[model samples]
Target: MAIFVHLTSAANAARIRRAGLRADSWARTGERGVYCFPVLPSFTVTHQWLRELARRGTRGGGMVAVHLRLDDDEPVLVGHYAGRGKHAARSATAAEAVHRIRELDDPRGWEVFVPRAVTAGEVRRVRAVPQGVGWRYFPGAHGTRPCTCFGCRVRGEYGGRRLRERLPHPLDGPDPKVPVLLERLAAAGEPGDPKEVAEVLYWFARRRRGPVEALIRLTEHPDARIREDLVWAVGGWRSPGVGELLERLAGDPVAEVREAAAQARSDG
Candidate 1:
């Protein structure tokens, strides 16, 4: 199975920065749909950002990038959420692989597949900005993007308030399995406790849809996990409210929570 991933231009730079990339380091997407941001973005809870792609070049299609450092750890999925089996290994010293990446012919643009789970933590290191956003942005068919690019071009039907509204939730049309899971968790759940809420949200992240909006509306979910999960879900929905919601989540106590919060605001 293969997984698809979409990330904004800003995230691509952040991913490299987070990985401790040096001034000379290079970052690019691989064949799979995974993105290899080294730093991940930073944002304000009150002002979540957006995932903006650059203008189209000659190449246009879903792509991925791999940082094949030789002296990292072992093999890992670059885009876990997409379920795409493509992967990259940095089992050798980082110096070795980084050298190889630079020598690739016409590496500027092509169809390259990478690992499954790509996050900032996975990068080795970078000291300065890499040419990520300038050269890379998640592409869609032709010059369109999976986000508003395609939606606006095709005049597609909006998903409606259910995808954006903060209240009542889209209980009628959300995936059926999620509702069942929510019920099971709710039956055994204790409200007001962030732990319970966090646990429930994690389960929801695995599904396509659930009572994610309801969880976001509740002010009681202080657990960064709960907060991140809610924001992530909302962003996945691509509700216009996504930027605002993610901005609110950036203040989470945990860096992981904050990173996830920043992720939700990407240019999608």
Candidate 2:
């Protein structure tokens, strides 16, 4: 009945640990029960706090099971096994950051689950709601079944590139479709909001891929959407000789396109 709202202090961690909390599980482990911490609106928000703790030299030796909720009181989802930061994490360490991100980015971190597969009927699901709708549905995963949402099925896109990334199977590694899907999303199904296509395309541009010089040439496509798509698309590739083109896209008029270019700068 007594829930610990603030694990912001070592005192709290120690107190929780004393209450038979298990490290890495929601339930008790060998009489060491796991203490559950819930964050409404965003269950994953705990990662931010926990990650900060790790950054500040506090490693969570005890496994903390994160429980997501709609409000501070309403329960949603519960998942287990988050890690404390390794003692050797650094800004320059890419692999460390990747591991940290992977652990923190646990899709199960949230209560409400959304599938990335946007069927024709689920268009509204992907619409730009005020962050809450998406947050309420913690990890949006599309099971093995096909999505029947309108927007998702509109152009054969489930939702954002994330849907494909978060599906239930084989998600621990980099998205396998990064290369081929980038090409297809470049030519994403037409007849919908060019903005949506641009969204998915921009996602491709942000993720992994190969070559940029050739793709930069495609940025010349007449359609503004395609142009916007290619502008960001270039950054996802690692080809040399296209830094200037990337620089130019960095200031593109479109907000998302410009955003993608800014992200590309850090990609290198």
Candidate 3:
């Protein structure tokens, strides 16, 4: 058997004890699964997801660690939590997943995905765990400059609004100066510095109104990063031809630019 721990709300403890764990959550690949971490020798590492999960608002009572015993041959998927799309998860048996994680030098952001529900018989015990044992937002995010984008800080999270105000994202901001922004946009054709273009688009995204005609001209900018920023900026614009511009960007050669265009259209 392989030992794994599923961290969840204490409020669900009674039900989990009675009925077992349901595969109620969607994995990165959009597959439904029950996520858990292997029971490593290091207590902190085994429970490292606690703080991040709590920050995601898994509310009820306090948090608890539900230990589970799975047969070595039970099917599962395992991968780094940061991977996206369908290919991120690797197929493995329950035992293989545990062994792979154990071999890693650092398994802080790794997770196991059990595709089927866990029966009550497989649950070993539910115990209280220290709430502050893990990383918040993401692993190694402590010293790095945080991305205050709407997708990152979001709107309603505690202290999110204040943080956005203090250290605004280039694309999501504390507003921008119209004159300075226009000057930069006008000069975009001169040297076409990608950073300057991104900054101009950021201001345009926040301002939502300006010399949109000049902004439209940059749609063909050679730099994909600028084009991505342009797609994001146009989301807030009420100007003419914005929809057409987005449609063109939706097929951008760069995947990130295309994704941004899709998101901008969806948000708009």
Candidate 4:
């Protein structure tokens, strides 16, 4: 038998003790499985996922490590957590997966996926582990510049909003460059790229000051998308004529433009 450990919330310890661990789909690929780490020689390496898993677990719940004993030839899938996908995990026996990971110089992100549920008989014990033992955001993520993109730092995550504000991405940052935005607006004429025009308008919506006259000219642009974007952008401005522009857009022929105008007006 090969020893492995699955870390989960301490709150679920009683249910897990009674019923074992159920296979669940938590990956983007939607593969349902129990994630575990091989019981390697290094104590810290064996329980590396504790901190990250706890961060994603219930806000106040502590964590426990459940040990399992599986047959050496039991089927499993293994790979780095970062490469988890529909086809990225490699098929292997339980023992083979442990052997491959042991050979690695650093197996911080490695994981094993048992496609089926684990039986109560397979569980050896569930013990409390130090909640603060493992890495936080990711392995080796410390001292490195973090990505502030929506995908990297999603809304509502702990400290995500503040982190994005502190280290904002150039394009998606809160502060907008007025001169470049005006240039983009000026060049986005009748034959301009609708996507580019919309992007410029998005930046305008983040700004407190800009050329209101330049934006007013685009209110008559043929593309309803540009007009809709213009409505949203003008909603952020305190300059003269912004209210009138929103009122005009609220009566626009396109339903989407009119809706955007109404929503922006409500938001302002």
Deviating ranges (above 4 Å) for candidate 2 = 1-45, 48-209
Evaluated against the true structure, the overall lDDT of model 1 is 0.39
In model 3, the runs with Cα more than 4 Å from the true position are 84-87, 173-268
Of models 1 and 3, which has the larger lDDT? 3
lDDT of 1 by residue, 1-268 (tens): 1211233334345554455322221123322223332211221110111122333211223222333232243332222122233323332222333333335442222222234434454443322222233332322233543333222321123342332333333332343366665675566555446665555655555443344445555423645556666765555553345455566667766776666665555434
Per-candidate Cα lDDT values, in order, are 0.39, 0.39, 0.82, 0.79
Give stretches of model 4 more than 4 Å off: 26-30, 84-88, 154-156, 171-268
Error of 1 at 207 (Å): 5.6
CA-only RMSD, every prediction: 13.4, 19.0, 9.3, 11.8
For residues 1-268, write the lDDT of model 2, one tens digit per residue: 2122222223234433334222322221222112223333454453323432222232334223322112232222233333234422122222222233345545343212111111222111111111122221123333445333322222222253455545523423443365665455456543434565566565555444555553565444445566666655565455675577778777777775665566566444
Could you tell me the TM-score of candidate 3? 0.62
lDDT of residue 252 for candidate 3: 84
Tens digits of per-residue lDDT, candidate 3, 139-216, equal: 888898878885676334678768877887786545557777877766766547888888777667654455666677
Index of the highest-TM-score prediction: 3
lDDT of 3: 0.82
- Winner of 1 and 4 under TM-score: 4
Q: Top model by lDDT, which number?
A: 3
